[model samples]
Target chain A: MIFPPDSLEAIIFNALSETVESMVFEEVVINQFVANKWPQVENSAWWACIELFPPPISGEVIIVVPDALMNRFTEATLGMGDEPPLAEENADALGELLNTLCGRLLAMRVGPTHTFRMGLPKIGRGDTMTQEGNNHKLVDCLVEDDHIYLVVPNQFWDFNAD
Target chain B: MLKILIADDSKTARMIIQRCLEMVGVANCEYVHASDGIEALTIMRAGGVDLLITDLNMPNLDGKGLLLAVKSSPKLTNTPVIVISSLVNQALEIELNSLGVNSIINKPVSPVKLLECMESIMEKGFIS
Candidate 1:
């Protein structure tokens, strides 16, 4: 249940990269993991969350991405060209992406022996963002020239009350 | 034409699975859509559904729940189900198999893999 920040960040990066490539057909590059010093963490970022299961080891994954990248992501997933973005569609795409990413990460971590049932993904505006707790681990990366941050809470804890 | 029902909360995932079915030369099939397992069960109860392709995670009634329902139904127990999900586990696989699931497909499901699974299932006398 104790995942070092650096190790969790690396896992998130790999999961993000694989999920984007397979789901949206986009080759994402991880620029670097910006630890605790992400200035662009706000910027009206779109956020998606997928909650994990199985007690003490349970935690949730939160993905934060910029608006422009989300537009491109939605377009790529639906095989569309540049156009006015549909907010709802982009949000749905992000939710599905995180679902796949979290599943892949858990499958890798648990090695297929244990089952992790992830809850449905939730998406909303960036203002919902809160300060990370002691168990929160985060990493900032660049994909398609846009910055995205991914966070996982300690022990799959639900810090936000819905 | 075969009547296949595909259930997934994500429209994109359902679309991808349908596209794969066509790519595998299941080109002459009729597709029914549902967003959750409850809807899928309702559709199946209406009868004439040749196959079921579903996702494990959904808002109302998940894939496992749907499988349990289908297996317990005397009229629908013979219908083939191919589960396509992002989640995978050895224990879950065994449970699904015991529930009479024809095949298990992982998400980001490829046309080739789906084609192989469908062909194998069809060979077992499920398809006409």
Candidate 2:
């Protein structure tokens, strides 16, 4: 199906913008939409993933933040001065952040009450997963000129299963 | 008053939703926040939301998982649901229907559309 691409981009940006501004206390412009290729299986670079299982339908959302950026996000988001919270140690918070951002995008698409069940956010530096679904695609965004990579899995949701 | 819940992994998302809702004249409504599916369910378990406005992808439980949980839960079964996502899958829409989702709205949500959705759901909520 042909989804509304521009609105989708706006949704992604709207969500990120709010979060970024709150954390940094300054508004940030989400840069133009960029697309990149991603993997399905797990990989070694530290990454955070949010899974949305829409019943018989399922999709994968991955956010790969370079170790350094992850640190900056936590610091800026949490208003950390320095010697900031470690991404590994702050996995829960980071996971929550990614999940929220992803949720905004999904909310606009799936509608309220049509939410997927969130799982415990996983944090690992290495163990690359490189696979792509027909529905799977990539969205590259620049927040405050900071690049953020997102993977939107193109998985066909099975509506027939009861 | 419209009872709305914004469930997403991002604080940014919640804020956006909140602003959109307000911009759409969703005033005097009680808005709640959930970090993930679990938190969303926790709120519902205690006493469900009249309408669930959420994202498909999230942490602690993605949007789809949350839908399943709601469908399975006797208390939250009737709660209206809406999904927002960057990836809109036709097949996934079918799957959501199987799960009994009331509606599916694609992402980059606008204040105008959100009002339409809320109005429709509110009308339905009142009927039942």
Candidate 3:
């Protein structure tokens, strides 16, 4: 059965919202429209990539957030909101957060009966994170004024492309 | 002090679970950590793990395999296993239940929920 586009969008949004609130202690609302450009801070951005296989679908879910947001996330995960951010810690937190988001999103989409195999999460920063070819799909959820971008690369969606 | 085994490929995950355990007032405890299910099983065989908390997706042997290995073992059958994963669906939940898993706690785990599971298992002695 083909899932409705609107339903898929809502599922992605809900997954992102729940993940951010639980992991980063931040609340966000998904925007209906797409953003003009990627969220970045002084030429730097953070991203986490996860690959999903079989079941309801197979694709890669990539989450990109601004450097400032990464700092806050690092602080929140470590329970030291006042401390300076650590690079390794920030990357690990982002990777883990994306991993959770991907898992929850897949579950919500397909239910408990069908299980999906998720690959280990990888994190990247700055220019290298937003390479120009296949970063098209986006799930833009508002976090205050800033936004977190979730991308499902085109290669993974080709199976369902009509 | 109770002996707890935490298995996840991510160091951050293992750390967070450990912190949550402490926050839930599980102070008198010793932790055994593993980066994957294979390592987790190795630790389990070494003995002394009162509780097993694992993540579903891992490099080798995964959570499902680990659970099966535990259930089939004579010595490890009594040890309760708590799964913490993001891949939770009704189908997965039912499967885990039938497999004799103690509990399934989703990723980005909530402290309150973790506490509740710990208390329930500690009081009841096991999920089954």
Candidate 4:
């Protein structure tokens, strides 16, 4: 990883903040009270993941959002009035959000000149758990009162690891 | 009225892009949607599309492939393309420009940005 742990964390936070604010017109703040590790599986309703490939670095970015927050995101993205968005609609919204967030995070970390490729976002509902290891990093955030988690696992920083 | 074709895998993204295009004062236009580049190409082949807006990453053919297909074809070569994506950098921008992309708009797109890009393309006579 080109950035130190703290720097990477800050980058993740900034990317998440900008993505959410721009896409959904909502504010995201770091949830200091929550631990950086993955939260309880039941609390999360949607999990979206995208793989990043940029030369010597590679990893997957996962975004976890609870049911209420997902509803808010879907409604905002689709501009729904009364009827709830379909399951596929929610999945698409989450995937697009993850795609944008991962792209922004990579651009910020890798600079403007370096090119990077990202896989299409894959989204799923129900319980999902993060891989267990010190090789990964997690950032907990809040959109209003709901919690969201951003996880980068495996080779997220393998190049600089001691 | 101009006919615009939007190609993106996500329905949500297509809706948002259409909303932004409307907000950017592209009101008197007919909109067509495609789930990927191949579909967009099919629609273009049918004729009468004034512009093409596409997302970079998609299944069964991407924006780059779509751009190449359109620019290479004699019938579709004149149609303008605008790429909206999150995976943009200087290198990619140069590549897209070389491939005849009229404009590139970053994701989390807004009406102001869309309008600015459209105005620039309009000045170039890509759109009237």
- State which candidate has the highest TM-score: 4
Model 4 regions more than 4 Å off: A1-6, A32-36, A54-56, A128-134, A154-162
* Model 3 misplaced stretches (Cα beyond 4 Å): A1-6, A32-43, A130-136, A153-162
All DockQ scores: 0.70, 0.09, 0.72, 0.81
In model 4, residue pairs whose N, Cα or C atoms come closer than 3 Å (at least 3 residues apart or on different chains), thus clashing, are none
Point out the higher-scoring one by DockQ: 2 or 3. 3
**Candidate 1 lDDT, B29-116, residue by residue in tens:** 8999999999999999999999999899998799889999999999999998999988976767887788899999877677887998
State, as a TM-score between 0 and 1, how close model 4 is to the true structure. 0.91
Span of ten consecutive residues with least summed lDDT in model 2 chain B: B84-93
What C-alpha lDDT values do all the predictions have?
Answer: 0.78, 0.63, 0.79, 0.83
What is the Cα-based lDDT of residue B123 in candidate 1?
93
Span of 10 residues, lowest total lDDT, candidate 3 chain A: A153-162
On the 0 to 100 scale, the lDDT of residue B126 in model 2 is 35
Q: Score candidate 3 by DockQ.
A: 0.72
What is residue A107's positional error in candidate 3, in angstroms?
A: 1.4
Q: Highest lDDT, which number?
A: 4
Per-prediction interface RMSD?
A: 1.2, 7.8, 1.3, 0.8
Query: Each candidate's TM vs. the true structure?
Result: 0.87, 0.50, 0.85, 0.91
- Candidate topping DockQ: 4
Using DockQ as the measure, what is the rank order of every candidate, best first?
Answer: 4, 3, 1, 2
Q: Stretches of candidate 1 above 4 Å error?
A: A1-11, A34-40, A81-85, A130-132, A154-162
Cα lDDT of model 1 by residue, A12-75, tens digit: 5566677888777777666554434423456567888888877324766788888888888888
Give per-residue lDDT, candidate 3, residue B56: 84
